[model samples]
Target: MPYRHYLLGEDQKSLLDRLVSQFTLAEESHGSLALVYLDTFDWRLHQADLRLVEEDLCGKARIDLRHVDGTLLASGDFPAKVFAWDFPPGSLRQALEPLIEMRALLPVARLGGRRDLYAVLDRREKTVARIEFLAPQVRGNEDNRQALPPRLLVHSLKGFAPEARRLADFLEGPCGLTRSETGLFDESLAALGRRPGDYSSKINHGLTPALPAGQALRQVLRQLFTTLLANQPGVETALDSEFLHDFRVAVRRTRTALAQLKNVLPAREVEAFRKEFAWLGSITSPARDLDVYLLDFPRFQGFLPPEARADLIPFRHFLQRHQRTEYQRLVKHLQSSRFRALVCRWRDFLEQPGGLEETADGMKPIDQVADRRIWKIYRRVLREGQAIGPQSPPAELHELRKTCKKFRYLMEFFQSLYPAEDIGRLIKALKGLQDNLGAYQDLHVQVETLGRFSREMVAEGDTPAETLLALGRLVEGLDRRQAEVREEFSERFARFAREENQRLCRTLFKSSSPEQA
Candidate 1:
């Protein structure tokens, strides 16, 4: 049966006292357990309307996956685990693997709580409903704890619909209870000064069309700067590859924004920051490259034949060893004075007064500036994409890919200024083409990287001949896949350049100014 959760008021009387006056109640069970909620940095489980809690009682611990309504979906003994792969195969693992792909689960909140279960009885001494009181206290460092509002969970028993409905009415009317929309997990996050789904790499600055171009671009930069800082700790600690990935993306977006929205800021200031961001980008690339290979190791192994699969173990070890080295190097650079100064100065530039200098388009309305910039980039995309042919070099496709990325970024930054549905449709069409181009480029890089790594292993010695042979097969497989991706490029580009999409793009972005509407 479905249950309901309610948040009690601070000044409310004891629930047991309120209940005793209505009916005879019997204590069912009572216990105290420490609850630690888990989710990825981006709140993956919360996004899926699920909660995973690790309950520690005395010294023993168990993990539970539950719906927001408190229904148990799965439960198992808590093990020493970081990633989902660390769990022994079970329903819990099955549920988590897909949702948290390539991300590590981290404890988002912790609370020590006591739970008391009671049975509401009828005159005939029959149990008609169950009420559970959860008294949670937020657990913090140095044995400090903060108590939160107690929650009441009411469960309906079979053949007791009227009793449950009557009890709910009484509680709502006289007891002054209300439903809790966010439940314990989010409430705990609130107590800790955090919010679920607070971190995201996507750009949504809520820019207005009539806002000054300078002010609007500053808003976007501020958000991107926040994201860049938020992901820094995770990157330094090597929590997961996604930390570095998101951090790099924030940097790229900042650079792209400054470059595309030229004249909104002083040219010299923009150029200085771009150089600093470019340096940051360069330092982070080696680690990110190795992370990609490590993350793709399983798929790379699949490319080998069954008999040769074992040979790739050495290659995996090699990647891990180098991944560590790259991370150490990356972290050192991240902690260096140069990086620190850049961060401090960049923050000041984005946040301080008098930071933005006078420029040509600084005071222009954002909608006018956005329409002009997007239209120019759209023309570039069309020209570059149309110029590609079957005989064109991979470099040409690569240049077009970069152009497409800039066009997409501009649209996303100013997406609020356009009709959502129309803009979204155009982005979807462009994404298909981008995906094909991305895959083609990635395969080419992989083929080259494999050759480079193979030579390094040989130079370092102790590399078995069979491992090289297995790598050769992997490269051969990648070559075949790259050919396939390349073959589909024409069709993908055609779809993106179809008359329908072209017309939509023009309708949405081709105008020179809001007055043109």
Candidate 2:
């Protein structure tokens, strides 16, 4: 186990001398260094109990993955600028990839410090327990004088708990050292006036069901706008595809809220903002579509033979070029004054205190409105889904997917009003059906996209015959998989529309009033 203590006194030399005299310890190593603490904007690594630091040790940059308790988990040489894919294939990359995903590992804080290493010796002069003293100074702002106080860390070697305890007792009694509540990185963050978990994109407004429909909708929209603004930096920087993905999701959710909570806000303004957001969604789609294609390229390649897979390299290059072009266009639009004005206007609208008093459903209790809308959407889903057989045209399933999305958005928006278990079951069942529909539509789109790519390749005249053949094979594979997904749809929808699920949805979401019920 690792033990940590905060030294109380200001005199470092006297403290070191006293420690040396009190215990059978010898100075082993000492160094002054600068360290940079790293984490995603959302603190994904910290939330997972992982700490990542970059430091200049031995004249080279080294990255260390440490536990929250300051125990070193893994260490490796890292470039000055590094991304997730920059880490070599090993335990560190394997461990970090899932946690950080596409977010950039940004430097959260910098600490310039000196460390002294000491080893406790047994009677036989054999090293047993170890201690480290760290004195950290804030970097980049020398005049602030906001350095982290010195700290002492005790490392208890295996089978030497007694010695560790003795040392702890002596420090607590004579040395006047107390345990520290904060870690080094956290202390550094505090010195810089920052804190962990300061930002998150999750919708966590604790709205009550009895709130007025207009007021509740405004609260929801404001939270989503906050999420949207939070992600704007990431999207503008093109830090990762997820930024745009998240931004678009916020847009979709906002649009859904506006549409679902009809007559709650000013109808004319709502419709105008709806059109503006629709425009936003349209401009974002091309880049997001390309992102999906590039992300799925590996899986697409796996569908071809090894020999044919090599041929797809040209296709990958094509995607990269197109994605860059599309993303640039998207970034330009996102950074435009028009986009900024729209978002500002939308924020003003959502933040406005009251809604039109003459509007229908504007003053109704949110629970009542939610119940009626959810039931209506669920009934529409049943009607649409039941009309489609296994042999139904793909367009029919595509339309049903849209309907399912609307129903899903309603459930998600009003989830807090109903019993958690019942709402969860309903959403879970709907998701299964939606997944099948989604896969089928995606496969169809991929097939069509590949067809267009084939034409482009032919027109370019620089592509090899083998690559075209592989592309054709890839298209056929996608069509076959699309058919397979189509086949699975009937069964998935059956499970979703089963009597148990229908009864659950009705029991939970159906209004208490007999007329509405």
Candidate 3:
């Protein structure tokens, strides 16, 4: 059976009532339902065109996964679960785990109301279709409530397609009802002063070539600042690792912008903020490191023999204990006056208008500045990548990694200034190299981190001999993987530095003319 939902327009309920008088409508069921919509902080499910709802009807709770168009894909009893992993092994868990990943499912919106169900009958008194009228109120904080527009749902029975079509046509033609495009999720979100996909970690500000470099830098900085503030509460609450991850990324991007756009902002202010952001990033590092390890604990266990996997349990416990400790220190630092002052001062500086002319390039057209910076960095990446040899020290690769990050960030920040397809292609090309480098660094970091953790565990006298051996095995595996990744870097960099990409980069970013815009 197909599910259809419509919103009742002005006085349409009376029109629907008058039209339904021609048929025999039998009351099926009615109840008050408490509906709570859930999604990740970044709206991952919403981006996928799916919504997860936990509905309570007369004390019975069920979690449902549905399309944006009111089609139910899966449903199960709503157990006391906060994350995908907490759910028992089932279809709902399977559908959610891949989408939500490590993010916690927070209640995005809540609505409370009564719904009445009626079965539509033909002259023969045979059930043809069912109708549902939902009148829900947005349940908000502090006993605040807002009424939403009423909704009508017509559910087509399996063998009654014609009747269902006729009913829908009648509703559309005379009842003055319209299909709901935004659906309840969006409506409720609106009532709560939020919109779907309102938050994202990616840099996507639109910039024009004619804009002043100072103004352009401010726009990007403001967006990054908003992302930082938006994720702060989630970080303080330790809701999920992604919140911290996004927060850290935003901080890093801010630092990059400050460092790379030195001549676009006042040097003294830029240096001050860069140092503060660096401090911020440093304070948040321990918790994030532990988060990565904990999130990858299963994979770590998989590297060992089945019987030996149990030996890592103590290590898992060790990580958990330290994760809690680090989170506490992290939250304290985030809530401190210094962090607050940094945020306030940064916001004030970004919000200011037209005072950055003291710097060298602040008044230049953004296109000219962007072209020069991007071209310079692109050449630097090429030079650095080409300079690395089979005997190059690991430190060389690390330096190249940092340079690649700066290039990537600059490209992303100014992507809108170039042809979308051309710039997108270049970004895609760089990502391949970035992924290889990222993997190599991660493997290297994990090996060193594991050794440090093993030493810490021994000092604390909490880890057993088996756990130590397990940690040793994990370190060896990581070392091998890191070497393999390092071995692949040459080919990856070769592809990135290929002629086609190089040519495209030169054609797109190497020009400062108005034609580039």
Candidate 4:
């Protein structure tokens, strides 16, 4: 049985109410179509992972996406067939993401006598997929397909991509399947050349350091990445995006874990990953930025009317063209052999059991790996902060900020084994430090971008002077807007950071005995 399913709530209701007079997909054949049944709540969370959303949007859950699925499933239970796939969790997350985000775009067809929601065909009109709930009358017949009241999900797909796995993930990622949906998902998968426990071996780790708890949290970062990148809502193929997200996560986690377990893994490997990730993060920035810009651009435009928009449009065009070219370049960078080799090496590293070297004193290395290094990085950052003067170079300050973030995340990830309150305090202080530095850096980037754009727009005066003047005004407005935010930001930061040293001391050593947070 598929673990989840996605159905139209309105259609489910209509069908449950025996009111699905509008659903034509059930009676109709959708050539090469697929339908996956997903539990609305689980699917969205499972689809758009918390990390990506948090990093991209907010620290807290966004209500905008919350309950979106249940809301979609506004109606009650209906007899439905679900198509299930037996794919790796990673693969499954990747495939079904699109449907979660693009439900509004899905074309509805009816199944059986119901009409509200039934089948979906892909963008290209090659196939149609519909799901039908078992008839109540036939559901009691044990010998028939309706006997189990199989929750049904159905799908039609083109060549090459495994339809069952792709379809199953699509259905199950957010909305879980019903008892009946599960039955149908299983039945459908069997029909399409898959059975339970059928799938490729999962790559469980990619550049991770053993935690102080030893192997308990070995691949937390990888898991985070797998959940985020693999399940991004768009893109035709699931593997690429999933892998990308996982890879980014693996990098981040491994880096964090290394900081926490510096005593275990070779320091050089930790440094190497940190350096590589800096490049990887840059490559991914275009994609991530584009995503953010797409979300907020309309709002940004709306802040001013067409007059302001007309001024900013050229800058927008420049931004778009630059982003496009940069994206293409980023894709190429991802495809480069160097990148693949790094991934392969990372995979090889993760497969090995690392950390905890046994010594002559009969002491376990992992014991020290967690305790000693955790406080050590914390101490170093604090000392560095004290030692560095206002005359410190930006490079030094930037390094300091990176160290704080690393330790902050480390504390959070391993809070299960730490003095929670103190670590939380430290995290807050580090955040203040980062906020100040980050805002400064963002302003710098904006200013630099503006200068470049101005030159490009003003070249040879091909367009009217009004457009240039408007664009210049637009950039000035943005700068002014940013400057406004910068004001009072420092005072808040200073208040938060003044006692960072005391807070770190209290948090790191708060426990009287060895205990987990």
Local lDDT at 196 for model 2: 84
TM-score of each: 0.92, 0.91, 0.94, 0.54
Clashing pairs in 3: none
Residue 107's lDDT within candidate 1 is 85
lDDT scores of the candidates, listed in order? 0.86, 0.82, 0.87, 0.45
lDDT of 2 by residue, 157-254 (tens): 76877988989888887888787766777677787887887777656566687898888788888878888888888877777787888899889988
Worst window of 10 by summed lDDT in candidate 3? 508-517
- lDDT string for model 3 (1-517, tens) is 1267787766545855675676578888888868888889999989999988888866888888987765678789864367889998988889889988898998888888878888999988899999888888998876698999888878887778898898888888776677876667778889889899999898877898899999999999999999999999998888989999999999988888888888998888888888999999999999999999999999999888899999999999999999999999999998899998998898788887445777898999998888988888888899999999999988888888899999999999999999989989988999999999899888888998889889999999957899999999999888888899999999999999999999998898775555443
In model 4, what lDDT does residue 139 have?
16
What is the C-alpha lDDT profile of model 1 across 1-517, one tens digit per residue?
Answer: 1367787664334766887888688988778847788899988988888988887755788888887766788778874367989888998988889998889989888888787778989989899999878888987645578798888878887678789888888788788888776667767888887888888888877888899898999998889889999999999999999999999988998999999997898788789999999999999999999999999998998998788899999998899999999999999998999999998888888775253446888888988889988988988999999999999999999999999999998988999999899999988999999999999999999999999999999988899999999999999999999999999999999999999988887887775565443
Better of 1 and 2 by TM-score: 1
Judging by TM-score against the true structure, name the best candidate: 3
Candidate 2 matches the true fold with a TM-score of 0.91
Q: How close is candidate 4 to the true structure, as a TM-score?
A: 0.54
| Model 4 segments more than 4 A misplaced | 1-250, 259-261, 267-278, 285-306, 353-368, 376-400, 419-436, 457-467, 498-501, 509-517
Q: Residue 235 in candidate 4 has what lDDT?
A: 21
Model 3 residue-pair collision total: 0
lDDT of 4 by residue, 369-474 (tens): 4445556666666666665554555566567667766666666665545544655666676677778766555554555665666777677346566666765565
